[model samples]
Target: MNKNKSEHTKDDNYLKHVSQIDQVNFLNFRRYLIDWYETVKRDLPWRKNQDPYKVWVSEIMLQQTQVDTVIPYFDRFIKQFPTPAALANAEEDQVLKAWEGLGYYSRARNLHAAVKEVAASYGGQVPVDKEELKSLKGIGPYTLGAIMSIAYNQPEPAVDGNVMRVLSRVFIIEEDIKKVKTRHIFEALVRRLIDQKRPSDFNQGLMELGALICKPTKPLCEECPLQSICLAHQQKIETTLPVKSKAKKQKKLNYYVAVIESPEGKILIEKRPSEGLLANLYQFPMIEQTKTDCSLLSEYLSAEYDTNLNQEQMLEPVKHVFSHLIWSIDAVKFMAQASFIPKEHQRWVDKKELGDLAFPVPHQKVLRQI
Candidate 1:
C-alpha cells in the first residue's frame, strides 16, 4: 500500500517501542523466550493438541481466567464434547451445564453458536486462516491470532494482555496498554518478531514469559534472559514497566440472594435473563441491595408470587467479585410451604438436580457455605 507522509507517520506510530527494540534485541528476546518456554512451559493439555476447536475453546476459557481453574474444565469439556460437531449438537442448557462455574458463560454460549455456524458453513472444521476465523462471532483479533498461530502454525500475532505486558516491559513502552493504539503498536511489534516457522511456540512463549517472568508484581529479573538489555530493570522500575491507565473502579451494590427452601426440600432458584451477566446460568432469587429485614423479605415475596415465603432464617452475607462489580449478597434462606407456580422468573429446583446445573461461581461459594 502506497502511503503519503501523514499515513506513513500514522503507521510509524505503531513502532513507539522501537527505540528499545530492533532486529538483534527482539531476536535475542525471542531466543531466550523460546528457550525458557521449551524448558519451563507448563504442560497444559491444549498444548498437546492441534485441533483448532479445542485450541479456540482453551484460549477463550483462559481469558481473564486462571490456568489452575481452566485445567479441570478443559479436561472435562474435551471429554464431554470431543469435537465441534458434538458441541454444536448439544442443547444450550447442556452446554451451559458443561461450562458451569466457569464464571463467564458467554464464552460457552458463543462457542455453541460458532460451532453451529461452523458445522453448517465449514463442515464442522474450525477455519485456520486468521481472517476466516475472525469472521466467526466472538472470535476477535487476539483470538484469531491465537487460533491461526497456535492451531494452524500461521505466523500471526496474538496480542493479549499477557503478550502486551511482556512486550511493553521488554521494549520499555510507555503507552497505556488499555488504548487501541497500544494494541496496534504491540501487535505490530509481535508480528515483526514472531518466528515464521514456529509461530505456536512464539505466541505461547510470549504468554509464558509474561505469566511467569514478566509478572505485574515483583518480576523475577535475575532469572529473565532479557535482563542485560531491560531498561525497566536498569531503571529499578521493573515492577512498573508497561505503564497503563488505572483499572476502572468496580461498581458496588447490595443484593439479597435467596437460598429459599420449601418444606418438601425443593430449593427456589431462578434463571437470570439470557442477555447480560451469566445470562444462561441458574441462580438463586435475588433482590437488589437495599435495607431489608425479615419482614422486608417476607413482604417482598408475598407481593411478587403465588407461593409465599414462609419462614425466615438468613445465611451469612457473602461478597461476590466480578470484573466490573462487587455484589455484597445476603443469602436469605426461607422455609416456605409453596407449590410450583410459573412466576415471572423463579424455579423451584430439587436439591439433587441442583448439583448438576452450573450456578455462577460466587453463588456456588455461597451454596457451599450455606
Candidate 2:
C-alpha cells in the first residue's frame, strides 16, 4: 500500500463523516452561521465595502497580525493611499513609512508591487479571474479565495487557521492541520458546504465563529451557534480536535547595535539590503556576532567607517523575536569622533529626518534609547 494513499484514505474517512451530514443539515449549518454573523459581526472598516482593494489590503495586513493592531494601521494606510493608483504612484520609502510598525515588511513590499501591476496592467482594478489574481505577487490561495468570495461573491473557500479550527471541531477531524494536505482537505469540505448564494457571508461567518467562539483555548461552546451540530462539542473534545504539529524552535542570533550621533546632531543609520530579513528598512549600524562583545562593535566601527566610538555608553539591550529567529541585541551609544564620508547605503539624518524614515520595530527600540 502506498504511504501517501494510506494517509489520504485516513483523511477521506473523516471527510465521509462530513458528507454524511446531508443537504438539509448543511442548509441548517449555513443558516445558523450566516444568521449569527449578520446579527453579531463586529463593525470592521473592511466589512463596510466589498471593494477588492480594501479587502486585499486588510487581508494582507491581518496575516500574522491581530485585528486590534491592524485596525489603526489599516485606517491610516487607507487614508494615505486611498486607491491602487495612489499607492502605485507613491515612493517605496513612503509606503514603508506607512507600514512602519507592521512586522512583516515583505507583505507591504509585495502588496506595493502587486498594486503597481494592478494600476499598470489592470487599470487600477483588482483582477476578478482566479488565474489573473493568482499571477499577482503575494496573492496566495487564502488571499485569492478571500478576494474572490468576499469581494466578487465567488464560491471560493477562505480556509484560514480560524476556519480550520471551526471545521475540525464541527466535523471532528483529527488530521494534523499543520500539513499542506490537511488544508486541501478543509478546502474541499468548504467547497461542498459553502453557501453558493452568500459565499461572502459563509466564509466570513466561519472565520468569525472560529475567532469568537471556537477559540484555541477555553472556547465558549455554550454560546456557539454550531453547538447543536458540533461533533467535537458533543464528544467533549472541541479543544483537542484541531490537531496541529508543534512549530520548529526559533533560532537565536546575537548582535551589537551601534547608535552613533554626529557632532552636527545627525544620527547615523544604514539601509538594509534590498532583499532578505528586514529588507530596505533603516536601522542603526549593527554587526552580527556569535556572542555578545562590545569590543567587536568598536572594531567594526573603526574598520567600516574609519571612526572611533567616543563617550561610549551601553544602553539597555533589546530582544526582538521574529517568526523564525530571535535577535538578542546589545545596544551601545556613542558620539562620532570625526565626520567620515558616508557610504552609498549609509545616511546621516537630523532628528526630524530620522523621525520620517521608516525603521523596523527592532531599530525603533534602539532609537528609543536616544
Candidate 3:
C-alpha cells in the first residue's frame, strides 16, 4: 500500500547514496577500515583464535559489561567451564559462583542452561546455524549475529549499540535508535555494507570505530575511516545523528542488612531463592523496608534467625545499582550465640570457609566489615 511505497522510497534514497560510491572509493573504504583494524585493534584474548566456544563465551560475558571487567572473569570462567560439556556438567551453584561479581546473574544461569542443551543435543558443539543458535536460552539476535560473524565468519550483521551508533553517523540515519524497528533497518543496512569475504573483521571494525572514533560524545571525525563519505560528517552533525531516548529510571529501594556473627566466630548468611534476583547467591540477612530504623533489624533477626540481637555498630550505607533497580543498604553488626541447626539454604561460615562460597557484591561489601 502507500506505507510500503513510502518505506521503499526511503530505502531507495539511502541506497542511492551507497550506489554513488565509485568502485575505487568503495575498495578504499574497505581497505582503510580493515587496514586500520589490523593495525589498531585491541589485543583482546578472544581475538586470538576463531574458536567458537571462546567467542561465544566472550560475547555473552561482554553483554552489559566492560572489557576490562570481563577479561579476568572470562579467564576464570573458561578455566572452570572450558567447554559446553564442562559448563553443562557443572552445578548451578558452581556456575553462579563463577559469575558472582559480574552482575546480571540471569545471564550466567541462562548460559549454563543453554550449554547443557548443547551438551545434551549437539554433543558440546555450539551451533552455527542462526536458527539453532537462537534456540539456546539468552542467545538473542545480536548475540547470534556476533557468534555467526566472529566465530563462523558468516556474512551476518552483529548490530549492537556500537554498530548502531557507527552506522547511524556514517549513513545519517536519523530515526530514533532506541526503537526496535530501527534495529531491523540498521541490520539490513549492515547486511549490504558488510564485507562478504571478511565479515568478521568488518563487523569488529565497526564496533571498534564506534567504541573509539565515532564515540557518543567528542567523536574523532578527522581520524575516522568513513569521514570522507560520512553523511553526518558532511552535515557537521555527527554528534547528533544517532538519536536515542533516555532510559527509564531504575526503581529505588532501601534494604536493611544484618551482619550477624556467631559466638564461634562464624558469620551467618542466607541463600537467595532458586528464582528471582540474586538467585542462589549467598547474602547476609537483609530485609527491604522504607525506614532505616534499627528496630526493624532487631525484630527481623529474632523472628527469622531465632536469635535476639542488638545493633552494636552501624556502617556507612552501601549503594548498589542493578540495571532495573537501585539498593541503598543500611547495614548493622550484631553478635549472637545460638544452638539452632542451620536451615537448608542458610549456613554459618568463618573467613576461610567464606572464601569458597559465592557472595554477591553487596554482601561482599558487608563481609569486609565483619
Candidate 4:
C-alpha cells in the first residue's frame, strides 16, 4: 500500500522541518534552554559536583524512579557509601538494605558489581573513556551519555524519556518513542543539536524542559522557552505529538503467602532464588494457587515441611504491580508445629533481625500485616 498525497506531504514537511534546524537555530536553542536551566533547574544533590561516582550512582537510582522519591535515598546511600571503594567493599546485603523500598533490586545488584569492578580495575576511579565505561555492568547508552556529558563535559547526548518528548515536539517527530529505533533517531538528533561548549547544561536543559513544562499531560506550553520554535505547539498538537505505543498488559499471578511463626515468636522467611524476578530477596514462604483456601495451604505445609497450620487466620490480601507482572497475594497467619525443621534457603527471623534483611515491597506489605 502507498501513502495518500496528504500523508506524503506531511512526511515531506516533517523532514523539511527537521532539516531547518540549522546551526543558527541550534545556537538559539542552546541559549534559550541552558539559560532557562541555569536559572530554574532543581538543586539536586548530585548536581553539586562532577564526581563520576556520584553521577553514576544517582543515575542508576533515578532509573524508573521519581526525583522526589530518590532524594532521601540518594542522600542516605551517599552518606553510607561515600566512594566507589566504600560501595565495592560493602556486602551485597547492605547495599540491598540501603536500596530497600526502591524497587528494581537488580539495579542495586548490578551497580554493586560494576562499582567493585571500578574499585579493582580502575583504582576506584570511574573510567573516563566511553568504551571503558560501557564495559561496566548496567551502564547502557543513556547512562554512558549522561556520565560523559555531565561528568566529563564531553559532547554526548543523554536521550531519556524527557529529552525524547521535548525534542519530538520541538521538531514534530512522530516516531513511537517506545521503539528502540526511535531512540536511535532521537540520539542522532541530539548529537546534531548538542552544544559542544556546554553539553552538560544542554542535555540537562532538555530534561528540565520536559519535566517542568513539556509534561506528558497538561503541558505548560505557554511557559516553555521553546514555544516559538516547537512545531507541535504551532500546530496546536503539543499534547498529541510524541507518539508512544501502549505497553502490553501485565501478566497477573496469584499466590498464597504463609506468615508462619514459631512458638518462640520468630517469623518464617525464605530467600528467593538467586536469579529471576525479585532475585536474592527474602519473602514469607508463598505457594502459587488459584484460590485462597486454607485447606490447600494446610495441605501444602503438610506436604512440604511436615508442619501443621495451627490457629489459622486469614489476613488482608496484598496486591503488588511489577513492570511486567502483578502479584495478587493472599496472606494467612498460623503457628507451625514446634517439631518443624527449616528447609534450605529458609529461616526463622526474629522481629528485630528483620530490619537487617532486604525484602521486596510486596513482602514488606505482608510484614506490616503481622
List the lowest-lDDT window of 10 residues for candidate 1.
2-11
Off by over 4 Å in 2: 1-24
How far is each candidate from the true structure, as Cα RMSD in Å?
2.6, 4.0, 3.9, 5.7
**lDDT, candidate 3, residue 138?**
94
Best by lDDT: 2
State each candidate's clash count.
Answer: 1, 0, 0, 0
Candidate 2 — worst ten consecutive residues by lDDT sum?
15-24
lDDT of 3 by residue, 279-326 (tens): 888898787775435666677666676877766799767989988899
Over the stretch 93-146, how does candidate 1's per-residue lDDT look in tens digits?
998988887877898899899889999999999986555678898898898999
Candidate 4 off by > 4 Å: 1-24
By lDDT, the better pick of 3 and 4 is 4
How displaced is residue 225 in candidate 4, in Å?
0.8
Candidate 2 lDDT over 309-352, as tens digits, reads 67479999999999999999888887888888888999888977
